[model samples]
Target: MGSIATRGDSKRSGNQGMIKTHSRSRHKRAQALAEMAVMVPFLVIGMMGMLDLGRAFYYQISLTNAVREAARYGAQPYYTGLSPACNAIPPATSPGASCPVPGDQNIKDRLAQELSGTGFVVDPTKIQILPDQGTRVSNCGTSGSCQYALKVTATYQFTFITPIIGDLIGNPLTLKTSSLFRTEY
Candidate 1:
């Protein structure tokens, strides 16, 4: 049979051990919270950087697609901008009777229409549309001959959502995409 005194002492010791375990658990919880507070900012900033980078990449791809579409439009035989000025022989400066080349503003409007819903604003001044008639080896009057090459270029401004990243990189990164296509006149 166990003595009553010994049983009482064991119970008290068990209670003290439980109290010590509770105290250690509280300390560990506080330490974990402190660590989380220190790490959270860095984690948030990293996530923001990734998000911004993804957005920039998406916009870049969109801009490239827009330019490709615009170039495709210009590559058609019907677009006035694709017509060569003065198909005459060298030294003959007379502008031919073809419809006047569509002005930069017209081309810009077409590009803007293609860029609609992309969340990117394109500047007309930054865009350049040019026709390479001199490079055409085949005669335009011939059937099934590619006449002229149209070149379209534009720059997209990508703004970052996070200020820290913006300061590290430029406020707005300029991403440029150009597309050239031969006209099927």
Candidate 2:
């Protein structure tokens, strides 16, 4: 009877050890979960900031390309079948049947169209054709004769999606791009 009692005591101690190990494992799992909960918000914010940075870079490139295309278009002389005509002044009226040829208004239209593909709503009012309607000569140097160039400028207000970052740097940022090209006619 004494031996049987000793054997039963050993079995009870082994069971108690297993129970302790199981509880410790449970505690560790809980600790890991608590740590994850604390870190998730910070990770999400960091990802959002990266996203905003990428968006801003993409938008800036798009604006630059659009302005460049518009300036290039404006620098060329319009062909009128008989000869290449360099129109010094753009039509004062709005774009319609009155202004059929490619001019300053057309340049603005092309810029707006290019920006439309970039997921940005372009305001026509923000597009500016330098010299308003005509070409200007710059970089004359000692030659006394300068090359004709056209300049196009555009502006857009970019809004940030990240609340914290937006607050840190004004919610809506203003982005501007300009391009100049020499006349090819």
Candidate 3:
């Protein structure tokens, strides 16, 4: 009878230990769930930041190419003793307008148009030309070797998926590019 009693007690103790193990497992599962919920937002923010950075990089590249094109167009001497390859530019009176005759504005306007066609939004009004944006000396003027200038500015607004610091949303991404060249004038 004593041996039988001891065997029964051992079986009960084994079952009790199993019950405790199950309770501890349940607690662990709840902790893991809580941790996951807390970490989700940080993961989302990191992904959004990466996306924003990629867009910024793409816009910067587009701005750089726009400036290069504008400079190339300005380098021509056809209008003011500039090379024929020079892109369209306005007279020596206006420095910013794209069309002065149609009317011709400045070399920058034409370049902006071309670039915007490539899926980027560009506004010439946001840009400033130094010395003369619309003014181009004639082929006979003493302006010497002839120089063409083009400046471009682009801005992009990025919306956050999870704004950790919400107040800074109004600040946009800004890019500026300028091109200056001395072509045949």
Clashes of each: 0, 0, 27
Ten residues in a row with the worst lDDT in model 2?
90-99
Ranking by lDDT: 2, 1, 3
Best candidate, TM-score:
1
Write down the TM-score of every candidate. Answer: 0.76, 0.76, 0.63
Give lDDT: candidate 3, residue 1: 100
> Candidate 3: lDDT over CA atoms?
0.56
Per-residue accuracy of model 2 over 68-184 as CA lDDT, tens digit each: 998887775454433222233322332212223356778888888887878886688988887655334223244332335667899988899999878887878888999988654
- The lDDT for every candidate, in the order shown, is 0.72, 0.72, 0.56
RMSD of 1: 6.4
Give one digit per residue, the lDDT tens place, for model 1 in 26-68: 9999999999999999999999999999998999998898888
Clashing pairs in 1: none
- The C-alpha local distance difference test score for the whole of candidate 2 amounts to 0.72
Task: List the lowest-lDDT window of 10 residues for candidate 1.
Answer: 88-97
Per-candidate alpha-carbon RMSD to the true structure: 6.4, 6.4, 6.4
Q: Which lDDT value does model 1 have at 103?
A: 41
